[model samples]
Target: MLKRIATALWGKFESTAELKKFGFLAAIFGFIIGTYWTLRPMKDSIFNAIVGMDYLPWAKMLSLVVIFPLVIAYSKLIDKYPRHKVFYILISIYACASLLFCVAFLNATLGLVNTVQSPWRLIGWAWYVFVESFGSLIVALFWAFTTDTTKPDSAKRGFPIIVLFGQVGNILGPLLLNARRLGFANSAPVVAICAGLMVFSGLLFCKIT
Candidate 1:
């Protein structure tokens, strides 16, 4: 029976409420992973378009420098605030920053329209670091929140479900935002969509937690 198969696969739940909690948690994980995957290719393409691929190593080096401060700030926030509050704070910051970048991409001077590849093009470097730091911080924070909240027995069942959804998002996110469909001319549309997903994920986190 389908019930037997699902029980075997996902383990038995004590209550319907518990099952629903895991389902929502799984969705939150999926959204975060999906947004990260979607942004990865966009980061490279936009950076290449605006700054040239030759400078990629420099941009990555910049990301390393930027991430340390970000992680430190994140740790301070975690220490100062409740975990859910920290999640909201960080998610709001990222969602707003993403939207700002989406709008920035529309500007002729700051965006892909500025085809000149100079080291002085700071937007490209900033964007590369933004996405890179986002990947590291957001994913780590989510897992930290998950482990803090989940009981060990529930996590055995729930973590697998969450990972499964995250993997699904990982596969689908980039596939949906492929270059052929969105084209390389403007990244605004893709960035806008990613921002929306980030916002939705934050909302989901609020609801679930």
Candidate 2:
């Protein structure tokens, strides 16, 4: 019964080894991409809620300003380090940033930090820019890794399944963030979960030997 399902889903590969390889890559890439998509919406929500609708245009402009230097630095990193090492650095930064924001959001909710005031609003604006850059950079790096590791022929057979799995992640990501049902009515837990996912994705990247 399971075999039939596997065959139907993946189609028959030329060898069992090839099938296993494709399945593993698909699962890893899917999880990473999906987790990313989940955080994408949350980022927007955070910015809008904390920074106000009027400030969003300014935030967008600020993000554009930040992205250029980041892109240049990322290009330099790529030139200097191995791809996997660069991925580690990127994910580590993301994990740390997520954790930092988790704390900030929690404090804001608890009235430990004033959301209406200067520093907190400034932090929110910075976060919005950082997340925008993080999403674009990490997703691009992931696909570059995918293309590097996958043979052209194998990619033809396997990339669609990988994307399919990622779409499932995209679906699940938003559902988990639903305010009422999962009880993620606060931002801290959501940010923490995203941090966990980022860590998990990093571990999976390490496993891609």
Candidate 3:
């Protein structure tokens, strides 16, 4: 039964010209939530541990000013490359990118630093920045790739289905993220598994796009 559900969940988007666009716009919302929701229950614990209550709002301010804008700018930067140049490399790059995001998430959750004043503490927060920033970037790039793959008319249909798959991931990811507080020592491994799932999703997006 699990195999059957898995098989059904992890399949290519069928090439129906009419259905491709369905997933396009939905992909954005799907992925935004997917990244956000992936670490849901433990978000506060992780944030407080790394950035601390004193620092989180400031960090969020920094992210809004720097990380968030860069993410948008990077998405628009897609236009800089010759359109045809976005090929197999996007997948490999995104996979590597996803791995980094996961590592960042794990490091933040572990608070693997001496103290808030330690240089290592900055590194953990930096990882947190990267995880949140790049995770959104990954989703944006995924849709951009899909738009490039589908015909202008057909994309409207397929996009929704694409988002649907990601939405499933978003909803399910939080459900699975419940292991965060078991022990600090084990946090990285669990986050790594979550990251692996993210990368696998990236691979699927690459395959279908």
Write the residue-wise lDDT of candidate 2 on 168-189 in tens digits: 8878877766555667556667
State each model's CA lDDT, in order: 0.85, 0.75, 0.52
Runs of candidate 3 with Cα error greater than 4 angstroms are 1-36, 40-43, 72-77, 80-120, 180-186
Per-residue lDDT over 71-182 for candidate 3, one digit per residue giving the tens place of the 0 to 100 score: 6666566767733244234434544654664566455343434234432456446555655565555555655665666775555434545667677767766665555444
2 versus 3: better TM-score goes to: 2
As for TM-score, the candidate ahead, 1 or 2, is 1
Model 2 residue pairs with clashes: none
Worst 10 residues of 3 by lDDT: 16-25
How would the candidate models be sorted by lDDT, starting from the highest? 1, 2, 3
- Minimal lDDT window, size 10, model 1: 1-10
Query: Can you give the lDDT of residue 204 in candidate 3?
Result: 44
lDDT of 2 at 13: 58
Q: Candidate 1, clashing residue pairs?
A: none
Candidate 3 contains a number of clashing pairs equal to: 21
Residue-by-residue lDDT tens digits, candidate 1, 84-144? 8888888888888888898888898987777888778888888999899889998999999
Cα RMSD of all models vs. native, in order, equals: 1.9, 2.6, 6.4
The runs of at least 3 residues in candidate 1 whose Cα sits more than 4 Å from the true structure, single-residue gaps closed, are 1-6, 182-185
